[model samples]
Target: MIDTERQDWARGWSKLKGFVEREGHARVPYEHKEGAFPLGQWVAEQRRAYGAGQMNGRRAARLEKLGMAWSAADARFQENLAAARVYYQEHWTLCAPRSAGALDKPVGQWLSNLRRPGALDGHPEWEAALEAIDEDWNPSWPAEWQRHYAVVREILAEESILAYVEPGVTVHGMDIGKWLARQRQSEVWAALADGQRERLEAVGVVPHVQALEEPAGAEEPAEPSTAPVSAFDRGVAAPGAVQGPARAL
Candidate 1:
């Protein structure tokens, strides 16, 4: 009976997978370039739509409403990226996965090196990547081939199944773009309310939890805006309640 149930479950999963793939693939934009990361592609489309005036009032309104949530998510990503840099700086040794044996020129090493100050700033690859940036801030990468470059290379080393490599040992560039996008998306998600959280989660959005916190500043938050008004009323305004703006107009 258990075997039968298991088989049925398997069949159901297969059917579900088929349905999702069909629907998802169909919705995919045909304009997808040969070598574009998924997030990069999405970002490009967003930029194009925004630039070409295709986003329209409705889209702008929605984005503005969502902007605060998005900003929070962005802050989180910045924090994560900062944490990752700290981790790499302290534990550069574990940057490469165990599978990368005998290859003295592993991708992890290259990526770690790139993390060093100014290492990638002048690199030909970096320059090429930057040059391909469209007015919408989309960079053109080879669509068919995956890159196992730098940080992506490290991710590949850590999880082979999580990444794909191509001719130049490039980790799937799409994954890299997606990683960056998630970091950005987290910024949006952080400021959202419960309903927004549910919506994002329904779409499989997951943010990277910050493993550490930065030191807190000694400065306190500014006093509330109404403070001065209240103080002035008590100290001087009560005697001449009708003053300033009231007297002016």
Candidate 2:
């Protein structure tokens, strides 16, 4: 009976060794198995034994040498976090669209998932890391709004804010003029949170409306163009239009 147990242990160890060599981590899911062998169940049993001080010293040492991840959630979160830091470094914000990703990780979708209420309830460290990366990573407003705001702010840095950004103007493919027009409308401006309005104002945005005489496009990406004009250029070039700051973002 004892010899049979030894053979069983050896078989499980061999499988785990192969798994670690291939996957680089001993994080097999609980429901995972190999043919008839309950490898994941065996791994969990080993962990439980170690925690309860019932595992043999040699066996525990071997598992430790394999770099077993005691807390799968922590290990996974850390990996995703590394990707997120890289993303933030490049984009300067974590308000990524649902489809956005970085470092081969679906960090944008990951962040969006966390934005759901109670997603990070017990993970204060994750929350803190996100906040450190971008204090407003998760704002009260729609993340899409925050993303567009970021684009407009970037444009403002290059030139003065325009009084009337026309429909044709585009920046990074975003219809800056159309978005601004909606923001400038009476009802829309009033609906904005005070903090949101303050941030927009800081970037030189003010309540605005396109003149009735001009035709425009809808809320969509600015059409592609060579030597494309900017929101600043469009509004500045428009006849007698005067608003926005002289300083750039």
Candidate 3:
């Protein structure tokens, strides 16, 4: 009786294994069909659609059901998009125009080419040079400026000098020149380290202010408009405006 029960169990297990094998084979053709669903390809398509602002609620839901989380994918797409923008801003000048009246080739293509395997196969030193260029490039000047500005304010505070102008006189503005003059006149300036003075100069808060006074017999220069000049308007190169590694290409 025991032998018969053991044989019955073996037969059942064998049948189950055969069923699973047959089902797997049957699913192969559908899964591997010319235009069937492959996870990587499907995810890529969804990402492209999302990046182009075409992924609607229904499509997003469908993708979620296929094990692709929309949030994670969208975040990655946004990050790549921002990086692409920076790459373009930094390297636009490096790209030669493809034709007359034509814009330079998109930076995306250059990035793709650079990222490909064997991209520097014949010239390994190019890779090292590019890395060095990247190390030297800074793309976060706004933050740097903010920190420097804070330090300048702190130094002024220690001297009890207001760095900003009277509210109605200049519409809540910073008088960089006045602040610099005060610093120069105060003992704090002499006590500051050389690096601190250098930092102040680097931020363009020097004691030198271009005289707006009109020359003798010349009309008073239109009263010198009160409108403020942004850093960009003053010809300051913004973050991502630095030369990039692509210049070597």
TM-score of each: 0.17, 0.55, 0.20
Q: Report the C-alpha displacement of residue 54, candidate 1, in angstroms.
A: 3.4
Residue 12 displacement in candidate 1 (angstroms): 26
Per-residue lDDT of model 2, residues 45-137, tens digit only: 777666678878888788889977556465566567767878777666789888888768899899999999999998886798679778888
- Two-way TM-score contest, 2 vs 3, winner: 2
User: In model 1, where do residues sit more than 4 Å from their true spots?
Assistant: 1-44, 68-114, 118-249
Ranking according to TM-score, highest score first: 2, 3, 1
- In candidate 3, clashing pairs total 0
Off by over 4 Å in 3: 1-172, 191-193, 201-249
Native-referenced Cα lDDT, model 1: 0.35
Model 2: worst 10 consecutive residues (lDDT sum): 240-249
TM-score of 2: 0.55
Candidate 1 C-alpha lDDT tens digits along 1-249: 379944743453343334345554212221222233332234334445565676566655543442211223233222333333343343332233323322223433443443456754544534333223211111122211112123433443464322122122322223444432343355755765554355334433344444444348837655445633322124322543323231100
Estimate candidate 3's RMSD in Å: 21.8
Ranked by TM-score, the better of candidates 1 and 2 is 2
